[model samples]
Target: MQIQEKIAVVGGGSWATALVKILSENGAEVNWWLRSPEDVAHLQQYAHNPRYLSGVRFDLDYVKPSTDLAETVAKADWVILAVPAAFVQQALTPLAQDAFKGKTLVSAVKGMIPVQNILITDYLGEQYGVPAEHQCVIAGPCHAEEVALEKQSYLTIGSHDIVRAEQFCRLLRNRYVKANPLDDIDGVEYCAVLKNIIALACGIAHGLNYGDNFQAVMVSNAMTEIEDFLHAIMPLPRNLTGSAYLGDLLVTAYSQFSRNRTFGNMIGRGYTVKSAQFEMNMVAEGYYAVQSIYELNKRLQVDMPITTAVYHILYERFSPALEIDILKDKFK
Candidate 1:
């Protein structure tokens, strides 16, 4: 007889709802923490998340929805952080330093901590004392909208402890979802962060009327940029061509569901940063990530033109056309 896995999914977003669906469907008891009390009430009453994925229903017996962060986390052995990167600190602020003392911390977040410029796994280790071996990162070529529709999706679990990563993978694998475990946690996490910036760049190019041919060249060059940045930061022995890295980049850069790309399209189409954000009503992780990565590279001095171009257009208030023109000259 196998023991049931109790998992806590922290966030009220589509990704968090999608994760709760996967785990609960796989027979794990899910303690879902949504910041909105109304959303929690709706999920419990309707067996569906009102805000994000309303179509996918949950089995209430296996999924417990809660508004209390601490209580949600207390009930699970594995806690998956799926909230947007900008809100992560605020969301977990209510917990004590040792609150995650013996649990496995999994980060489904793909952006760096704003101002602090650290990965989610690093923040977990520093703030909550969760050791690296017990921490994991969820990488995609996967999307929440696809998961809700039961479309084929693949996920990569990156962790320092491969065995523990594989254990979590078992909970995620199902009919339409395939989960694989990789040993390079930091490398995978960094690639996830970088891919969003690339996606934004692609969106900017598209909005500027740069056709598929030009975007293809830009994406190819962006891969080289990702390789350079990853080598400088982590210097791990890993394959960048793998689905966790390249596949994820391709999807985010081209997918209609990518908020970062949508956010960038608005910028390229002549919307101000604040205006784009206000209109979308969603957090594009790359908006926060570009600033963090740009500042970090000031010390590391990595040649990240796409990241630099995004930071300039977003933060320095440069014209998207001007920046993209300058950026294209540098790409092969």
Candidate 2:
């Protein structure tokens, strides 16, 4: 594992920590950025993140923890954005527009711009002038928790440049992890966003005590809903049954580790949105994603019953029980 790639991983969350662990363990130099000074100090001293995946220790010689955004991005050949979508703008505000000019940007975020409703790659292209070929997205049936536990996991690197994607994939693959490249960047990214919404819907159903049989119908109907929406927006030919699309959807919907499902279950079990968010203390990307997708659909006019049902319950203050019951009639 004698690699010479210098990577910059932005954000201090579990996913960011996990990426740093993988890359550094594989012998790449990682310039890690964290918002909090205390977390940086903790990682530098303890060789582990105090707040996230603390059990996994890092080799400090390969990991350089820092708080300076510009310096972190300046030294890396590749920059991975692992921050939540809601704070993406704020997180990168300190850097100049041309900061990412020659660097390969990888988005590990499974969300869209909240109100603008654009993908991360789109936003990077528009705001920073990064081209489609220079950008990549990390899609998963893979979760950070599993990565920390050394459980077998699979990841899809979606990019317009398949060669570049494959090159990047080599940096990720190891015994417990398998990385593959996909040419359908837009399709993969959009599926990542939509699946979170589906997970929330599934969580809500589970919270309502709807059994596996009912959820099976919901997931099946959701696959159709996703197909229609992707066609309406991107109009690309893609296999939704791939690991990046349906596998990711199924995992997020059913995994006990899904924060989105936990959030939805709380909402279904009589907790308000605010209360659930407060209690969990983590960002469930689906909560923000549902709103963006819902608002975007107003113009696209796609028939997304699951997304619509989620938006109604989360945004419009519709009763969860009422929404789920109504959603039941729409599903086959």
Candidate 3:
């Protein structure tokens, strides 16, 4: 736990590559894991990830590449999960064999399973038995491109263990990546998933050429809905108003870097839901989260109006423009 003696960056994705860059810049002896042997060879040889975060070169000397999961886990004092939302449960299942060795489990995933309706955090807990006490959830407005470019960005690290939390913070804090220690692990996790749903809505509005007034109203109502939703599960005081919530929502909804925004924007441009998803290629967390949240509403009965609208647009084949009009009517 002291400065992440040997770190494993799991999954061969843009976020994982960006985090490996962070670790390398911070002088971490990190083993970066790619699912493909070819990717491993490229990173080990050329220091590049062509499949995911292409065009961003890494410092291969500081970081080693491994296609073997067990080999990477064996060398890790901490393992960072960077897989897509749908793959998270499968990713954690193999780790149940004590492969992680009770090391710090840090997740960068922000989506849920559409079929099971499970949060990535809870799924990891159940499958890998990574107790709530040892798990860390990192979420923020940081983009992989920005981190790859070494642009200034910060993210939140919330763990049940304050000591591990602090050490992880110090380990990842760098000139380019700033890690902040926080106490609300659950709030951070839920906010990370839920905010993407709102971002999709914002992008849809923008794609439809709805002016800033419509975007303003939708996001404002969304913030209130998210705060209420997070509060009902447990007690979340002022933390929801911070970066993990509004800051993330604002940027993801407005920024062109967001795949969720792009996904929604295409939907607004009159693309079918499947077409939108097919074009994006990347897993849009909000697309999955909306379905999960809609399923959750059956029991929780919390009014996530924005989420409901997005769900209708994505799943029910409801017209995106009509749904926006409906959300406007309901929230207005």
Candidate 4:
């Protein structure tokens, strides 16, 4: 189960680039898939990703860059899917179901499959026929920006199989990075999705002129909502305060590196949804996650007031100010 044989990182975005940097730093042979030929050529010629995490350079000899998704994936023993959740289906669409058969699939995505309203691992399993044992998720308080700076960060490798988790974890561990393997695959992945939505709520609060006093209460309430939702949907015997859950939530909600928070800030500052999305030029994840979770919760019936408030403002066109006012009453 060791990932040293061959590993492919499927995406060229900041997270994907950061992963490439980490793997390359470990001197592991990496097969990289970026959508653009121009970008691939740029990486080859310049030893760095042209679009995202451009500051982190790679050792050219240790990496192979490709635009062929199926071929790249087929060659790897492990495939780390780092593309945006929205484009994941499209990126892997060229591959046949059997392409992912024996390879371990690692999800570096934090968003849901919008069409299926399911976690990325579930989507890969159902859509691509990859088995549950073959799937893993990378959850974090770790951000690509921080990773690029070589700042200390912690990551949780969530999988049902501890062997696979430990193998992947070994590849990610280094001086500035710490990796832990967890058995709570469902809870970890679901919490990763939930936290992005909560971060958006926090960002909206900040943009709408809510002080630190209210923002503190809002994040605390958001954690309870996360606990309630995961407990109902997953029911795993796990600590919600751990880095994968609460730590991830705090970083995304408070860090300047969070795109979800940036998106919500724009919304709160009077930008339309289309405009905010357009200006960012990157998927916020929470924008899509809120819809998926809102629909999923219709059946689960979790008491997620913060999530509901975000859903109303983002999807139902409710004013951010009015929604926050209403949300405050639910928090205490």
Name the runs in model 4 displaced over 4 angstroms. 1-3
Q: For candidate 3, what is the lDDT?
A: 0.81
- Writing each residue's lDDT as its tens digit, candidate 2 over 27-78 gives 9999999999999999889999999999999999999999999999999999
lDDT of each: 0.92, 0.94, 0.81, 0.90
Q: Judged by lDDT, which candidate is best?
A: 2
Per-residue alpha-carbon lDDT of candidate 4 for residues 1-332, written as tens digits (9 for 90 to 100): 22456899999899998998888788788999999999999988999887788888788888899998888888888899998888888888898978888899999999999968999999988888999998999999999999999999999999999899998999999999999999999999999999999889988998998888998898898888888888888787889889998999999999999999899888999998999999999989999999999999999998888889999998999999999999989886
Name the best candidate (by TM-score).
2
Order the candidates by TM-score, highest first: 2, 1, 4, 3
Candidate 4 TM-score, C-alpha based? 0.98
Q: Compare candidates 2 and 3 on lDDT and give the better one.
A: 2
What TM-score would candidate 1 get against the native? 0.98
Model 1: residues with Cα > 4 Å off, grouped in runs: 1-3
Residues 28-75 of candidate 3: C-alpha lDDT, one tens digit per residue = 888887878888887777778878767777766668898778788888
Q: What are the models' TM-scores?
A: 0.98, 0.99, 0.94, 0.98
TM-score of 2: 0.99
Arrange candidates by lDDT, highest first: which order?
2, 1, 4, 3
The predicted structure with the larger TM-score, 2 or 3, is: 2
Cα error, residue 252 of model 4, in Å, equals 0.5
RMSD of 1: 1.1
